[model samples]
Target: MRHTPPRAVEVHKALLAHFGPVDWRPSLPPVDELVSTILSQSTTDGNRDRAFERLKARFGSWEVVRDGEVAAIEEAIRVAGLARQKAPRIKAALQFITDRRGALTLDFLRRMPVEEARAWLMQMKGVGIKTASIILLFSLGMPAFPVDTHVHRTARRLGLIPPNTNAEKAHYLLEAALPPETYLDAHLNLIRLGREICRARKPDCPRCPLRAMCVYAREQGSGGARE
Candidate 1:
């Protein structure tokens, strides 16, 4: 059976009881978060961090990065991997923002409805639903649920969402099912669960807090259930 909103809420509560509260708030401006999220694509967090720091240290400002040579941008973020692709995309996103809004700031999104803001961000070449939701929720403090790989996988295993739902559709569906206030905590906890317990390969389902409710755990039989 497809999981209902109440079941999703139950999963959220169980996760909270296990992992406690997490602060997923973004400490950077929207533009910075946008670039950081872009840099994070197909890379480890450590590499993304290094690349972001390097890019900032080299350019000192988004305006400079926006106008800087593509080669320099690629070199600065080389550690992130896919610099050839990410560099031009990042520059193009910034340029698009600058041209459309007459500035590089994403603060204006705070005034737009959440969906409107997401749509605006998605219009950028490299920004997809996940990236846009990250920018909206983390940067703008808006109610957007970003369905990253971890969240997507965890949700499917828990039957909170369909197993075949695409990340883009999962983003909207999850946001609709979950309470607005639960988005950040749920997002963080699900990611932690995916990383530490409900891993992609050979999940440590025996120790998972959601094992009782997870379809994947049940399918794994008693081996996944702790004594």
Candidate 2:
């Protein structure tokens, strides 16, 4: 038998039906996506985008960012919050890529095995599993699954992952639970659900399409128990 969550496929299908077509495509180039994701840490989408635009407008290229002063980078991204920290990581990541590949582009990861590519990205100064996975999956179309805050919370509520699983562990659990082909759709739909319905403070369980399979809804006495 496949060592997968029993109802993982069912939950994925329900989310797809609820969200309609998950039209998530790789929007940014690999290097841009990498830097954008780093800026997104602990910040709202609007703030992240503003910071990214400012940084881009200021430097115009990652190579310049790599060679630029840390103070300049930090000033460019102060709106993203934690610029004092994120700026260094972003610059360090760019430098690491340049040093390792003899170029500033992340295009080489396309030819490596997905796991190897993911591991290589994580070796950068501030890149972690989520950031690396997002870069590979979103930008490079690799099979890696990214488990963000929304994905982690929703998966646990749906009983697809163990309740005690942390964000890092949830990455592997969710990747194993769903098929590689469904990774992008599943990841995007889960985030939509979490942000729109399964909110942190007020989950609209009764309206959630996956409520029938959600342990959180059942625990709240709002839905039938999962079969």
Candidate 3:
């Protein structure tokens, strides 16, 4: 990542070719995104969405969520797994935003520098780099790249970062590899690859479009399906 990673450009192009254009638009308000992302931890997408929907239905507003009974909140998001832990974190995040910004909105982050915005959100309980970056890139259209489990795995396998790199460090390494403009598409595409072809338990290396340039694929002797 000393310079624009020469491999990253090819990886981006190949992923786009295989996955088609990644047309991502913000799907939630920043606050909703923050809460949903917090709920997404250690859970599947279906579970995360279900939990968010239930939480929203149970508490009609962020203010209500902040002040509502934690037991009630925990019950609503129980399907998400670790409901006990997530419920309090969710309440604390809303409370922090209310306390610091004097309201429930995270819209103010949209106007600040990306780093400043990231820093501000990370101040909230349970809001780490991944959660903050998701709120930034997905909701606020900022340039911060979030390194989730899928992304982290795919990045290392592709030799984009050091093999032993941790998720936090991999975030910056990937940011340094691809341009800001490619973050959304690249991030989504990498996650797709990880889920479909480069899966955690038994990656389908032979069927992967990235097999030609992927370090793991080459090592496994699986040529690119497309290449």
Candidate 4:
């Protein structure tokens, strides 16, 4: 292994070659992005989209979702799973933002520095580092990397970071390696590669551009099992 890890530019180029410019993000309003990110937790995107549609049908606006009855909100989002628990959390977060800032818009946080905005978002209910980073990168167009399970698995398998790196650590390590301009695209691109190519049980190494950089792929060549 090399002393200092290679730059993310090379890694990113390899990733892009394997997964040709994935642009699959939901094109919603920033607040819609926030709500959808919450709804997406512990559920599939399709199911979350269904729940979001139902919620929109029932409420008609973010203000309604923020101020509506918890029971009704939960019912609207039941398809997303754990709606009973997630609904109130979503509504409460929306309410808090609206109350504290007079608007639930992400503009306030977007104006602040990345760290400050991330901290403020984490202070809200149900907003963890992953969620906060998603809000920043996806919604606010800020430079923050949101690492999910797929990213963590792929990064470890490729020897991009240490195997035991938690989501937060992995996020910063990746961010530091790449330019801020690459943060948002890299997040989505890696996710696509993880899902389509570098899968958990059966990574399509032969078809992956990052195979050359992947420790697991090299191990396969040497007849060694993946960790």
Q: What is the lDDT of residue 217 in candidate 3?
A: 82
lDDT of 3 by residue, 88-179 (tens): 99999999999898999999998899989999999987999999999999999999999999999999989999999999888888998999
Q: How accurate locally, in lDDT, is each candidate?
A: 0.91, 0.90, 0.91, 0.82
Candidate 2: tens digits of C-alpha lDDT, residues 107-173: 9899999889988998997899999999999999999999999998888888888899999988888
Clashes of each: 0, 0, 0, 0
RMSD of each: 3.1, 2.8, 2.9, 3.1
Give stretches of model 1 more than 4 Å off.
Answer: 1-4, 222-227
Query: Candidate 4 on 8-77: residue-level lDDT in tens?
Result: 6788777677566766564676788789999999999999999999999999999988889999999999
Deviation in Å, model 4, residue 156 alpha carbon: 1.2
Clashing pairs in 4: none
TM-score per model over all chains: 0.95, 0.95, 0.95, 0.91
Question: Cα lDDT of model 4 overall?
Answer: 0.82
lDDT of 1 by residue, 1-227 (tens): 44447988999999999999995547989999999999999999999999999999999999999999999999999999999999999999999999999998899999999999999999999899999999898888999999999999999989988888888889888987888989999999999998999877878887988888889888877264332
Which residue pairs show backbone clashes in model 1?
none
Give the Cα RMSD of candidate 3: 2.9
